[model samples]
Target chain A: EAGVAQSPRYKIIEKRQSVAFWCNPISGHATLYWYQQILGQGPKLLIQFQNNGVVDDSQLPKDRFSAERLKGVDSTLKIQPAKLEDSAVYLCASSLNFHGYTFGSGTRLTVV
Target chain B: ELKVEQNPLFLSMQEGKNYTIYCNYSTTSDRLYWYRQDPGKSLESLFVLLSNGAVKQEGRLMASLDTKARLSTLHITAAVHDLSATYFCAVDDSGAGSYQLTFGKGTKLSVIP
Candidate 1:
């Protein structure tokens, strides 16, 4: 059983630039989630998907952030016109149903 | 709104000592999860306490939940350097449908030999 996989362990971009993060969840997992973890803080849920459909994204910044899980197996989170406040670690996690969440290594974005 | 808080944000103790971290939530939840994360690393699942009075133990660590009190505790027995890391407690609010977790700020533990 492979763990959740994420791409681009680290990223650096200028303010107002666009950035995207990719996540490939573990096989057979039915739920996937994206979280933003600022330094010295807990991870905050950005979006959640059950299969190909979104379950919740109320906390997502509609004006700048968007996420999609097209085939239910992989997902992507994008931030357009990124801001300095958007510099944080983006973590992807997969679960059978909210019990044990297998997390990816995360993409650390640094916006200057 | 759901809020989770952990006590003693930082803990430093000698190896072989016993200590416990506490977690308190604002609302009712179906389950609570404990995770350990090393600096610059992803989180690792530690324990899941489901239902009131649920308890689980592994190695030198034990986790328990009290739904009525809306609290959870992670107890470390005879701690070791290997257990040094940031521990987080997350709650899954019932009826939220999201199954999204509300996490505490986390307790950073440092065990010295």
Candidate 2:
């Protein structure tokens, strides 16, 4: 089976600039998640979508980070006015139901 | 809030040796997962333990879960250089009314020749 697909493999942006990352989940997976992994740390959940409708996003910084999974297939995460601390790897994952998550290669963002 | 902790944040072991990584969570959850990640790469699922006392093994790695104690473990048997990677244990919090994973800081493993 094809793995989750992510774009831009890498990105560099200046502080206060805007950037977006895209992800295409595995075929037929109903749940998609976005996680932020800082250097030498675990991946933290940023947002979750269950077939287009948001399931959880309590950890997302609404003021700067926003994500949407339109049509319940592909997802896009955008960070506006990016901060230096926002420089991290953004990972996208999908599950058939609630388990067996498969993660994408991730987008490495370097905020200058 | 849920917290997951892994011991020995970093581990350096000689090849042909054995070691175990521990993961402890602050809350109750029956689902535990282990994932391996190489530098500059995505995570690869290694194991999924669903119930207390569940144990699963693949290749040179084995994982066990004890939900009663809110703990999980990944054991490396006869470690090899190819096993060098970051290992993470994540707990499913759906039982807590949220469908998300709470991950541990991860253990950076380096296998020395």
What are the Cα lDDT values of the candidates?
0.93, 0.94
lDDT by residue for model 1 (B1-113), tens: 89999998999999999999999999988599999999999999998888899999999999999999999999999999999999999998656666878789999999999
Tens digits of per-residue lDDT, candidate 2, A1-112, equal 9999999899999999999999999999999999999999999999999999998998999999999999999999999989999999999999997868999999999999
DockQ of 1: 0.84
Interface RMSD of each: 1.0, 0.9
Query: How large a fraction of the reference contact set does each model reproduce?
Result: 0.84, 0.97
| Candidate 2: residue B65 lDDT (0-100) | 94
Worst 10 contiguous positions by lDDT, candidate 1 chain B: B93-102
Alpha carbon lDDT of residue A76, candidate 1? 95
Q: What TM-score should be assigned to candidate 1?
A: 0.96
Q: Which regions of candidate 1 are displaced past 4 Å?
A: none
Please give the lDDT score at residue B10 for candidate 1: 96
